[model samples]
Target: MSTWMIYGANGYTGELIARQAVRDGMAPVLAGRNEEAISKLAGELGLESSVFSLDDPATVAEKLQGMELVLHCAGPFSKTSRQMVEGCLTAGAHYLDITGEIGVFEMIHAPETSKRAADKGVVLCPGVGFDVIPTDCTAHKLKELMPNAVSLSLGFSFLAGMSPGTTKTMIEGLSGGSAERKDGKIVPFPMGSKKRTLDFGKGQQPVTAIPWGDVSTAYYTTKIPNITTWIPLSERQIRGARVMSLFAPVLGTKPVQNQLLKWVDRSVKGPDERARENALSYIVGEAKAEDGRTVTVRIKTTNAYTLTALGSLEVVRRMLGRDLPSGSFTPAGLFGSGLVESLEGSGKFEVVE
Candidate 1:
């Protein structure tokens, strides 16, 4: 049997992945920097556990020795991904992470790392979450329908819930202004002001250009000349995000970001029972062909984090099962349209043309 590792297995999302892995009969090795937490969760789930801190390179490489793949759940990935990815590559293990950080995603696409992973014949898939999967898959689906699409407009309609860690990560990213490729070059954009309303059958809500994983993943997948991703926000949250955006340069300071993260951690719930019951994410994309023809694709799902775990697990299963091409790639290039179909078959989502 091939061994799999679930790093950060004690986190809310991490634990969820661990549970799903066990259910799939994979019996992953639950691992993290915190021994007690990992051990407790592993014991409860009837799985093995290990301790490996990303801060210690040798330890990480050692712990990953026998694993064929790893599902990294801990974030903010901006801080931890490099080391984790390096360790995985050093151990000759396939890697997957649910990272929405544009910086981290871009880093993985860097020439050196990309060449290294390719040369080693290992797979490196990032953004296996609501961020990239739904958007990238939607882009792929649209291209299938329109074949000649040159640009895309994507929006997410989500009313469900957010984990404390996710909230903190967003806050941190917002405090630092986000940049997107515009006219083929990266440009800074205010986190809020670019609002557009999206119809999700129920009603239309104003969405803002919050930096999302789709910005990077879509470029890699569809080769579209332009792509924009938006997320629906309540009026109040929009106001807060706008205000924060105004003072982003200052708020992005280390002390301020740390304070904001601490506050969010205390106020937001990571993943309570309520969140599991109420979570939802709807992604819609519009693709425009050169001749001005258009095609639209939409995907809706519940339990966003659960689906993220499921997506990552499915990717790992495919890699281990010899169903994926051996190369460092994003989800789109690795699984393509088949990924979207698999998620739909999971009975957790619906797709509409």
Candidate 2:
């Protein structure tokens, strides 16, 4: 039996990870609810696979026996993570997911969930993908530079199309509005409620506050009491987001979400090989101390999805080979500030004056 599995092996991001794993010569059991797609991918990759769904925890647990870890790729994880997590706990398998959902991070990090994972000798780490890994590491590095930092801001800009999973997650998150960590508590604000101008290696561009996973995971990784996340967007996109906020409630309804998700399934195709090869992503982080001093750092990396595939595999391989203390952790918290730098195709973190 393979010690690890990649659930959702047929999804866009999942398929990327699966192909990457094969290229890297690591064989992991591919698993998902879609037997046809999963079997096809498994055959193409010449790796073992199993078909299963997350509907029943007990059944999933039984199926997960003998697996040392699961790199969950299915999303919006807000709807799929709970059952899989429960199954991991029962089966004593470490849990990892490429989820960016704020609520999902909070839920897995909750006292009860952490305690259960600890008791079961399991590790629960979420946002191990592009969702939070780079930002979390940047926050950790800045905190090290400004030990007395009281405020932290992180931002990123990526040039790539969204996968169906990513698009559906965005649709579901529409109702939650934007969020930030203020004084160590998650606070909600209206969508596009805040904006600023920042230079993410490029010239100064207008950026708006968005509810990113770092808002939830950064506080844990850096112990920064105040944290905010941003992404560059044009005035038109900002205005459109503000307009959508007015209808957030109706959009959040199940029927509306279902319809929007159907549309996503029909139209959303993730970036292709050429796009992924040509695209790049940039991230910036700043830490402010009470004495009016600040430290800023910027990072350049490969395409977002590519980074996720490589980064998640590195984490998985290490966790499997080493004996990390059993509990929940943010990516940087588990690995260290150098986590992102250790991955291939990642650039050095340049300190800015």
Choose the strongest candidate by lDDT: 2
How much RMSD separates candidate 1 from the native structure? 2.3
Model 1, 5-111: lDDT tens digits are: 88888877888778878887888889888989988998999988888789888888888897888888888898888898998888988888988888888788776
Best by TM-score: 2
| Model 2: per-residue Cα lDDT over 1-353, one tens digit each | 34899999999999999999999999999999999999999999999999999998878999999999999999889989998999999999999999999999999999899999999999999998898889999999998899899999999989989999999999998888999999999999989778888889878888889999999999888888999999999988888888888899999999998999999989999999999988898999999998889899999989899999999999998888677898899999998889999988889899998
Candidate 1 Cα deviation (angstroms), residue 127: 1.3
- Go through the candidates in order and give the clash count of each: 0, 0
Q: What is the lDDT of residue 108 in candidate 2?
A: 96
lDDT of 1 at 350: 36
Error of 2 at 149 (Å): 1.0
Give lDDT: candidate 2, residue 214: 91
Alpha-carbon lDDT, every model:
0.77, 0.93
